[model samples]
Target chain A: MSTFLLILITGIGLGALYFLVASGLSLIYGLMGVLNFAHGAFLTIGAFTGLWIATKVFPNPTTWTFIFSMFAGGIAAGLFALLMEQLVITRLYNRHIDQALVTVGVSLVVTALLGGWFGFDARFLPTPLWFTKAATIGDAIIPVDRFIYIGVAAILLIAMLSILKFTRIGLIIRAGVENRSMVTALGINVRLAFSTVFFIGGFAAGVGGVLISVFSYGVSPLMGGSWLIYGFIVVVVGGMGSIAGSAIAAMLIGITNQFANYYVTGLGDFVVVIILAAVLLTKPTGLLGKVSH
Target chain B: MLRWKYSRPLLIAITVIFAILPFAGDNPLSKAGLQQTMAVAFLFGALALTYDLLFGFTGLLSFGHALYFASGMYVTAILINDFNVNFLLAILIAVIFTSLLAVLTGGAALRTTGITFAMVTLAFGQAGHVVIARDFGGFTNGDDGLPVNADRLPDFFIGVVNTKYLYLLALGILVFIYFTAWWITESSAGRVFAALRDNEQRVSVLGLNPNRFKLLSFVLSAAMAALIGAAMLIVSGSGSPRYAAADITIALLLMVILGGPVTRWGAVLGGIIYSVLSTRLTVLSDGTAFDSLPNFIGGPLAEPAFTLGLIFILIVMFAPGGISGAYYRARFKYLNKGK
Candidate 1:
């Protein structure tokens, strides 16, 4: 029973990380109608940036310094994404297939740059002193870092949902996603809304990267490629352009992967991929996705 | 097979060039390394040609075509190595098996279009990589790759050595694939594929099921890809897990783009040039001349794949139609001036 509780917590922690990543991807896909393959590269960039700051810029960094590093990472990713949007993606709007190919090219370039800059070896991030302890909940003991990740993810999720549901910008975004030309016709600056959404998406991916790096203790150039695949799976299974669906799908995949890892060992990644394919076969629209066409 | 009048002569010229390439190694016409490079290029040409059928002609951008290729190689390798199956029979089985796999996956994948289909296929490709690396490691030998014993292979196979005979075999298969692709494009069904590529909704409205033609193209493409895989195995004498991953698919995508999609001869030319240039570029990147450059500038440039990525972006951004399109436009302008 205690092991079950532990597994559940572990799954939720994993899910929270995925939720942070996939939600951003979902939002971008919803509004821009572009599958940003470089989303994972942003995560890698964020984590690496945070690590670089914590170690190189701030010697013997405290918990507060680490948090600041995370923010810097997110900001860096956001700026990079803004540039990508203004330069490359803006030209390829409405051409989804071409957009896919170009984004993949962007991803490769970013990944290669990271590899060249940082070298290919995976490096561990210096853990904040405060996160090294374990927290006991009921009869189950959980790492404090895991709990912190879940807490942070929950706060971000609430913030995103409230923004989307309550704010004028959120309404505009929702409307723009549904009918960009219609929104443009109605005199709403759909382009600005998309840019804002793209920035936020990049920001979320960066934060997710920081969080995952905090837990995993390192980052590599290739790390983003694997996560990008999983992020695609989550968004697809949850339903494209649906944040709620993506979150649910992320949790399901995260949990399944944990269980599969515990029981089946090496087949964990394979099982999740198979599940994604099965979901795609059975539910083309995804679990919570509205019929796109 | 459909003959696009102008390309017929070009195809014959390419065939003749490849036919003579192995013999030209000792002469000033070709370098010693040319034969091996062309052999691998022909295999890649076959792979790109099949991909062209799907993406360029049929309007289906599949990201998991590498899975079919790897499946073909592995099945044949396992049959010949482990089960002592006859080489010819194994090749036949590999083709049939991969096409059937393609049919099954394509049936499901065709339900989605554009990026959704690409992602679904990506998932399959990733899954295939994992399966080869882990689940079926016993047969695949995981990342180390499963090698075919030299003695087990028939007298025809070079068994890991890139030889004149292997080059001939690859060239022969490539010719077959080129002709097959050309014929498909010339067929009425091929016309339907072209129509589907232009506008699927309009074709469906005309009472033609786009999915049926998509499936046929998918199966045909997969069969050709698998044959290339078989040819690769015969040349390299091993099947590696990399064959089942997205890298090969992306490389083929790059080649197709370079050649210009929807142009069969362009894809072949793209494969040959990319294959040759990549090897040369890798050498240049690692050579002494690049060493004198500053670290920041030289670092990324030292990797040919990074340069390829840059070129891919440039092509997608500035010149979507690629070399073939440029040539056609120039020729058309010249002919118009003459008129």
Candidate 2:
């Protein structure tokens, strides 16, 4: 029973990070129509940025300082994304294959540069000043960082939901996703919206990296790729650009992955693919997502 | 420039070069640098050409084509190691095995269009990755990969031309695949795909069921990729899951897109240039021509992906016709001038 709870906790913890990363992907793909292959590379870029800041710029690398460094990483990824858009993404706006191909080039370049700079090695931030121990409750030992991850994911989810619901920017974003043609036809500057989407997408990817470091506490250049695949699976299975779909799908994936890892030793990935394939076959539009194709 | 067209002579030129280049060295050609280079280059050319069949001809942007390639190589390696099958027979079976896998995958993947298709394909590929890593432990040798030696081949096959012969084999397969793809593109089926790309909805309305054509293209693409994978094992003499994973697929796509997706020879040229540039960069010293070059140009501006990304950006923005597109246009202009 305790083991189940531990798995459940870990699942949600990891799922939340996935949700954070995927929400932006869902939005970008839905709104801008760019697949954003470098989305995960941004996460890796964030990890490196945070690592650089945590080690170099900060006076004292406290937990607070580490958090700030991660925040910096998010911002750095966001800026990197904006630059990408201004140069490359802007051109391949309507062509899906071209967009995918260009971003792939972007992904390759980012991963290679990181590989060269970091040498495929991992550099973990020094353990936080506080919250290093696992807390035991009712015979279930949970890492405090796991709880932290859950909290952060939940907070971010709530914050994103609230922003999308209440904020004008979020309102415009939702509108843009629904009817980009109509929105642009109304004489609105849709390019600005695309730029904003790119920034948010890149930022979320960075934060996901920071959040995921709890389980595997290190930053490797290749770190973004595995999670990138998971994030895409969640977002696509949930429906390409549906916000609520991503959250629910994240939860489902999280639980499924946990169960698969525990029960079926070697078939975890196989199960995930089967599930995705089944979904693609039967529910082409996704469960909650409107069938666009 | 004379190597521009896909003429019969051009094809023969390619085959002869591929066959001879690997053997154009001192005795004990297996240790020859040319053999190693030809072997790698031939397989890569095959891989890139197979990718071209998918992206260039079918208008499918797959992010997981490497899965099939890997599948072929893995099965072939296993057959050699466990059953002691002859190398040629192993490759034939590997092709069929992987082609079946492609048919199964393409059946489902063909249902979705555009990015959803790309995502679904990629997810399945990842699943293949996981399976290879954990479940196929005995067969794949897991992440360490399976070591394929000369024992896989028949004793009479032994010569100073192991890698050289592999290069010839890969080149033969690549030629057949490339010509086959070119023929398909020029055929009525290829016309349907081009029409589908222009407006899939319209094609559906026109009573041409696109799903069927898409499936066919997907299968062909998978089969072609499988052949490349088999060739890779023959040349590299081993199988790494990573080779047939998303990474190489993405690289091949980049070269295809950067060159010109619609052109017959664009992918070929694009692949060669991209591979050469990449090899130069990683293998070169920091002070070498390429090391300081892409960095000096790309970094002084912004990110590195920025420059390569920008090249595509320009192509998409200003020159949607691609490099080969320009070549075709120039050829047309000259033809008109002659007329």
Task: Quantify all predictions' global Cα lDDT against the true fold.
Answer: 0.83, 0.75
Q: Which segments of model 2 are wrong by more than 4 Å?
A: A264-266, A290-293, B1-11, B21-31, B155-161, B199-207, B285-322, B333-339
lDDT of 2 at B135: 47
Clashing pairs in 1: B1-B183, B2-B186
Residue A146's lDDT within candidate 2 is 76
Quote the positional error of residue B122 for candidate 2 in Å. Answer: 1.0
Clash numbers, per candidate: 2, 1
Give the alpha carbon lDDT tens digit for every residue of A123-183 in model 1.
8788668788887888888778878777877887888889889999999988876777788
Best model number under TM-score: 1
TM-score of chain B of each: 0.93, 0.82
DockQ of candidate 1 against the true complex: 0.66
Residues B65-98, candidate 1, lDDT per residue (tens digit)? Answer: 9999999999999999889998879989999999
